[model samples]
Target: MGVLSFLRATYDLDTLDTRFTNTSSTPYKTVIEARGDAAASKERAAKWKSQGQPSRWNTPEFYLYYFVLLLVIPYMFWVAYDASRPTDPKYKLYERLLRPGWIPGRKIDASDSQYNTFRSNIPYMAALLVLHPLLRRLYNAVVYPVKATGQGSRPTPEEADQRLNQRATFDFGFALVYLVALHGISAFKILLILYTNYQVATALPRKYVPAASWVFNIGILFANELCRGYKFGEMAALIAGPTVQNSVLDSGSTLVSWGRWLDSYGGLMGRWEILFNITVLRLMSFNLDYYWSLDRRSYSPVEKQIDPAALSERDRVSIPAQAKDFSFRNYVAYAIYAPLYLTGPVITFNDFISQQRYKAASIEPARTLRYAARFALCLLAMEIILHYDYVQAISKARPEWGRYTAAQLSVLSFFNLHLIWLKLLLPWRLFRLWALADGVDPPENMVRCVSDNWSTLAFWRSWHRSFYRWSLRYIYVPLGGSSFRTPRDAARSILTYVLVFTFVALWHDIQLRLLVWGWLVVFFMLPEMAAGFLFPKAKWEGRPTAYRMLCCLGAVVNIFMMMVANLVGFAVGVDGLENIIAGIFRDFSGFCFIISASMALFVGVQVMFEIRESEARRGINLKC
Candidate 1:
């Protein structure tokens, strides 16, 4: 009996939590609403969350999936990696295709130009993380002690304000020092930009604040990009007057060398303007959040709880506290919080300032340690892939299309997209982990594996989830996005999506390709939206077989469109995608290949559906 009990306990035949209670206050409602879509509220998340999840191990389809993956994935990987080999028959034909500006004789890591900026600073980031706890303890000791007024008592309002002021001062001081070190003298220029924006936020009429903030920040962003962050050489030349400037500030002059050395010493981010896009978002978050917080009726000016840790993530993010917390000191500290300054799992002004007052539930130590481990593992995985697969190199080199089959180009484009995802994912995770260690719980950026996606809408939601949420709250909602509103208006939503993605494209970079990419994303989303509208599960659930079949087919189409859009946008660009498309239609063989691939995608979509069902059964509905 004892042995049987031990075996049963260890094995746990019931792998999933089948019991799903649907009470009003159950966490699932919050989860659904937090997704910020009215569609989710219409029993999508709720109904799914209540379903009993069966183990995939019990299903024959699972074995089929395993077999297919075993057969296909390895072949895909081999084809992708094998083509880059020097011994491959076509390698020499494309050897000269390597793009310029990279090392002439060496294989290029296209992502290295971007990723090395983060990788090279690993030492600095590591040292800062190590010293962070000690530094925090020091700050706590001097500014706001752990026991401010002895064990059980809290400090008086005056004392609390003074302590907080000291802490903010300390935060701003550290942020200033770090920024100056990172951007050299250009840090002042950054501060000035923020300061001027700050005045606009505070001084403008309530109605005008939003418009002014948007215009000023975006205008400055374009100006900065155009001027290349006010190059030190240009600045010196301008200061010197045209007559003497040409001779005095030649490329080889002492001043030129000095500027170059300073930039090198400061690391690659010395210009500060390069990272201004991210800073611009934070600036908007601050200014916009503050502008909204001004209306006393809508946003209660009361200090309900001096500590906002008790508030939910939703409330903490969307709601602002008393006006006092939105001071310039707090604003600057939040703007340049070193870990998130470069790339953000962007936290809003309210959330950032509030989290500083008290630790939130999200900052679990064991969880953070696990997260850190995951980040390290991801970094290792990226390194291994970079070492083995030169797909990025090959793609950037623009190898001869005539030398490769349609399948080869597809695999190259596919893996290149995966590499792009990993490249962004690894850095975002690293910075997020760093912020976690510092006890600031910014949102996770990449929520799903790039390949795990089957829906175009869901892909964007999972990719850069923080930014999505930021855009949803700040941009989409303001532009009258009907995701959360009642009586769903498709026209309004579509228009909002167009406007949002348009801004998104420009915000990413002042590039024409990105603008096209944004439009393509919106265009692709139309079919998915239309299908969801036509097949309201409530009306079609009686015919589960037909509904499931329809969904599976839709998923396949969604996946295809998603791939094309992403390939055109991020992986291959218009020219490369055009080449791939042309290759596919070049012969009868390519048509047969597409048919087989579509069948494979159908099977994969079924597995993806089951995976989501299994997650829902276990009360782990992500909706995305």
Candidate 2:
């Protein structure tokens, strides 16, 4: 009775009981706080004849969830920490902390070289962020006053066009200078690539632009990697024979000197290839956006009278009313917009152009500052994790995993995924925060915590959300992704995922393992999609507890599958993942551990469900 009383006091179970017991045909309407719309979601629910909103704090299962979490979380961490500790006396902890001359930072440094590089470049990114606002202020002071005089309170359409054109020209010049300073002579190579893509859009017939642009841009990207950025004029040799290559190769020493000289400006000089993937995405954005605009088949219309601030997400990425905004000047500026150039929470060409003309309505100084604080906290958390946890180092070392228990190996893989999550989240947030402060709002790449997700479909939706959105608009939708009008064809949807992931895998790296990982992800989603169809909410609404229990069971399986896919793709290679799986199933004890772990995970999923319900009550349905 006491325990039941505590549970009753903690959760609004009465609301949930009423919701479950009632068989009302009419859907309940609640305020949609996320969109500030109360009736919209309610009407949509009614149209679909779907169940009403979930009750807030309605979960009665949370006590068990908390109890399981308390035990599992600490045990996992304890095992991971114990297992990862260096056996070598030479690599002393005191030395790692103090950094004496004898002790190097091999252990202290992140095992993942990419993250190490990012960590080292934090200062440079910060410096760029600082310098950008000053430049923006200077431009505004010079330009805004002149435009404000003729146009009364709000600028007229013609004046807005003139202002945007001038800004684009200035941005183009500045971007060129910035790229040259950052990448030295190699900046010309990037510009040439962009120029070629632009020509494909402008010179080709509208019918041919889509195929031509994709083929050329994707072709160039693969070629760039295959030729290793065409170092030592090898591309020239391959294309134009030994004579032209010899001419270019003869000046290698001079090129080296040039690179060294340019490196004085910043350490990242002549490393344009490192950031070329992001550039390629921007290239495609310009090409496709231009192609779409030429047909006047507006994905979202941008009429002269439409307030840019009031436009929805789709509208912001639509082509502007004036065709001149699609000029080479604007294209260059949008592609290499310094804030988003290094690593993007990608903004489409139209969105970038629109935001430049009128600052995003989302840009609030207080909100931006709060976001900065969040970034700082995340960075600090990552630092603390790195300082204490050496799971990444252990994974890199590739010691005898057989020696460690299944739980330890599981925890090791688990923490490594978390590290991957944080490392990515930090840089994306930093760059995005910079963009937000500069009055441009790119998509937030990481929304949900890595551990918070349960559904595979929802996981993809939230993780690297900008990239997901980009792929959806440019690739998925065009490839016949089922929206409201079209009925969902499972086969077509599966094929679409295959193609999308194929592009995604290759785009990340031209590696076989990533491709395999993508296939694994597709395979895992089959069961999830099937389950969603087989055991939909409408069918199980009467048996709420049973339905919740069933979902929790499914979520446990999903969590393991997700971990396996990610582990194979990012943290550990095929063999390492093989070891983890083999170790887990090698004995009866291992089997028992799996049973216990699954139960714990089931509880965790119950908690996850409630969390989403809580968010729904607040009118923030992430749909993930």
Candidate 3:
């Protein structure tokens, strides 16, 4: 069995035994009633901000990113090509490299037509720059009417057409320029993003232009806002609400169901899935933010776990929407904002729209330069890391796993989490920088160090925070959350995990792997849950040193268990996981003994650090 299975069977899990809240709590009922329509809170527009409009877009520093891009793209092609031809030492090694994935009709050598060349891919270099102006014009037009009608009125046909005139006049011209200048672009890789962007631009309503452009034109982007905001999973459940369990099903029906899931969920085309989901799934949040902005009843201070009694008369959530009309352009731009379209720090519609005015602000030139430098450094770091080809390096070495010692493999398993961190870290940094250039302060994703998370809970809270917030704010709070007036039941705690994790896993994809991974996380989180149940008001440090030491040891074993579980569910295959488990018990080698000790020592140190920090933060008055 895999490490996770072994742990699952062996670990002595403590059940959270507590009194159940048999009836609905007053707090829960209040949240339910207050959710229907927002009570009039102070306009969010008048709220304070610390970032304070960092810099404007028009400065020369804002254009520094173009130079950085020029440097990176060539390097990407070089790395991809070089990885394909590992042994060959020569530059322009396409003749040796067997690159089947890249586009054809490209030439590097006269000897064979198959040879890949950067020379052939220069048009893409041109296309990246060329597409920007077209995008800007189209986006500006969509947002123009939206800002003009601040009262939330629908745009008139004349208003739409007047804005669409820019597209009408220039859409054909831009397409022609693109076709001629960058005709050789392909369907895969980076081009796929460009292709999606092109499609979005083409899909923008162009009533006066060719009829094809307006055929499947978008209705108001906030169609969900106009209607009640429904999350994607909720919508899916409602749509598949008619599904009934049948005892008459056979194994073939199970396969059929899998295929159906693949079709309906993300498996149809994975890139399209990424494109569709990151843009659309958050529409519920987008719609809700819009709803909250318009209706006063939507803002419940208690919903955020804040005390309503502490709320001031001028209380608001940042700002209310001042524009009379819904800017489909603004909404779409924020949703699919290119850099963050795939990897996200998910800025809500309100936050994004609020920052646009700063994108137009006249700021100090020095600040603009500083922002550019910092962004360039961040991009440079990502590019440098990417060039290392860490994923491929691991994949290439996987076949020779037996050659490495069991302890080495376990160490690898542990650091696999770190590897995943580096992979995500760059893209998130890139997303933040990309948005920041436009004066939008997308919230910092990794506040705590990636590898230094004190506990499993702390790690997740910082990891993809926007998604976590959505789960907590939307799913957890409505389901009674931890705000129970009565003691929480073990069953309810488990149910909270079920809803939050299943939603997260299914949100990523409806695959078994993700489900397993999500459950693994739930298992890790159980310690925190159980602690809450067992110690309702007890303090940790206030106890005897012997007790605190015992707690520290438990924390060590807990983190190690989680590391193995994470590796089993995510990083390694079943065989690898099994090998690690077997090694832990069967391997009598000194290295195995050594690694076991180090892993324990490391976790102990981390736990101590956490306790120290907690004590420091509490100013010696409270015990952790």
Candidate 4:
């Protein structure tokens, strides 16, 4: 049976007890009853007598894993070098030293650029990989011995998991690696620019010579800002939100829409995105920090017991112990991937670990081939849209389109939006399949498709699902789940939308001012939220036609509001209520009729294509 099947059998409360009872009536029943008790003295004695001690992997084994990972870095570098042939004159010497020094000269092409970049950073990566395990082992070795004597040091599984997850041993190493690599790269680029500028300065007449100091200062500032912003944004996003919550500084506008917009458009120097990123990063980092702190607590064995009631039913039902265990591995794997680290899929630790474990398992060739093909096709489609600049044009026009243009542009925008969604969704789906095929079981509630291809809202839900999951899990649940009272729920939901949208806006760093765009969007979503509360019992019953119409309408209004907000926000930065209201009134005609018509056509095409695809899959024709 598959992992999912195994988990179902193990956790299925309805059938599990019966199977145990039937297998050995007396002992099994006693064991089951004992397991149910919070503090089963008799059962504990029996378990101790029977099991003696739990087995664990030795320190050497742990070190070996790290060593293997370190070796893999070099191997990857070698593979890249072999795949990318350099045409430069220095290539022959670089190639000759490959077997000994494992270094290669740079190539100007894309492949060469990627390879050289990875190769240059191999030492840092390898150090990070090795240092984590080494420090962990050192901590264990040093700390355990002192506690073994009457001083009372005990190592629990939770503590070990915490240590593993925090990767406390390796964090500094990784930080240093990042710093060195980033600064080194920045310095090189700055120096090159400086040299170019000096050459230009020298070429000019002596009487009209430009000050190289000014050019140098600018280069220095640019490099400093880039590195500082990247690091500061990352650290703040990882660590700041909770810290600032209780501070006096936190009392400022809880709904600073305009401030957020200014932050998005104003560049990194805009305090909004930087501050917001810091807050989010801090929130995420809190989990790891909390888990690590748990290791220091000397609680009774009973405290170690998993409490399903403590967690929400949804989370409890979705995650199995095996999945949780797998997440530790996933955290390490995903953390190192720079792209995801900066802008996440916001995956749970459990999901990540499961993905890694599954990737390590066996896979079918045919299934792998199919996954590759799907990913390639999705990527190709995205490239085509990007190359044509269709999405960019629509996005640019969105804020200023008159009524007709607004309608027309919304339609065109839908296709581009669909392509973007497809790029994220297709690869994710393939990854999901790859995990399942390799024996990793996904959560039962994972969304499979845009709501029957009928609702734009559904499409939004299906696209970048990790964001939805994060919003629901972190924001919605904490405020109180859907059982919230009508007025309170509506208010909380709106606030949640504001927070989520603001976070997303800051995440993109489009401009410091664009944070207002997020706020405006949240304000618009308020109507939808109110509608949701008013029709609490309205079920989305997969009625494609009805949902599709609703979705198109929602999309049009959303895109229209977004465009106007963005334009005004960017132009004036975040302003007071009076200014914002005035700006909206002033730009009321920004929604052009042509744009509206274009948006209509775009939606029509998408709807038609969706219907055709559905029919093809089901082998049934549907008349338009």
Structural similarity to truth (TM-score) of each candidate: 0.85, 0.84, 0.52, 0.41
Give the per-residue lDDT digits (tens) of candidate 1, residues 111-176: 446765666677887888778656866887876664355343334444546555655677788888
Off by over 4 Å in 1: 1-57, 89-111, 142-146, 150-167, 236-268, 297-307, 483-489
Task: Please list the residue runs of candidate 3 whose C-alpha ends up more than 4 Å from where it truly belongs after superposition.
Answer: 1-270, 290-329, 357-392, 395-400, 483-488, 532-551, 573-575, 590-604, 607-624
Model 4, span 289-313: residue lDDT tens: 2243244445322355533222222
* Displacement of the residue 103 alpha carbon in candidate 3, Å: 27
Question: What do the candidate models score in CA lDDT, each in turn?
Answer: 0.74, 0.72, 0.44, 0.39
Error of 2 at 215 (Å): 0.3
Best-fitting candidate, measured by lDDT?
1
User: For each candidate, C-alpha RMSD in Å?
Assistant: 6.7, 7.5, 18.1, 21.6
lDDT of 4 at 449: 28
Steric collisions counted per model: 1, 0, 17, 68
lDDT of 4: 0.39
Better candidate number, 1 or 3, judged by lDDT: 1
Order of models, best lDDT first: 1, 2, 3, 4
Give the better candidate number (2 or 4) by lDDT. Answer: 2
Summarize candidate 3's per-residue lDDT along 1-624 as a digit string, tens digits: 676654433221100000011011122223233445543212211231221222223446325534554554454445443432445332233232222222243321222121122224325533543455456555656643333533334343344334334322333343333332322221122234333433543353433222221121122122323322223333343444335323212332444454445434322123233234454434544554544455443543445664332221112224443443235544445555543555577766554443443221212233334544443554454334333323223322443454444544454455456655554554565555444443444544554334455356666676766676566655677676753334566568677877788767766655577677788888887786576556543565466445545555556656666676567555674566776566555557836565555544444444455444433332221111
Index of the highest-TM-score prediction: 1
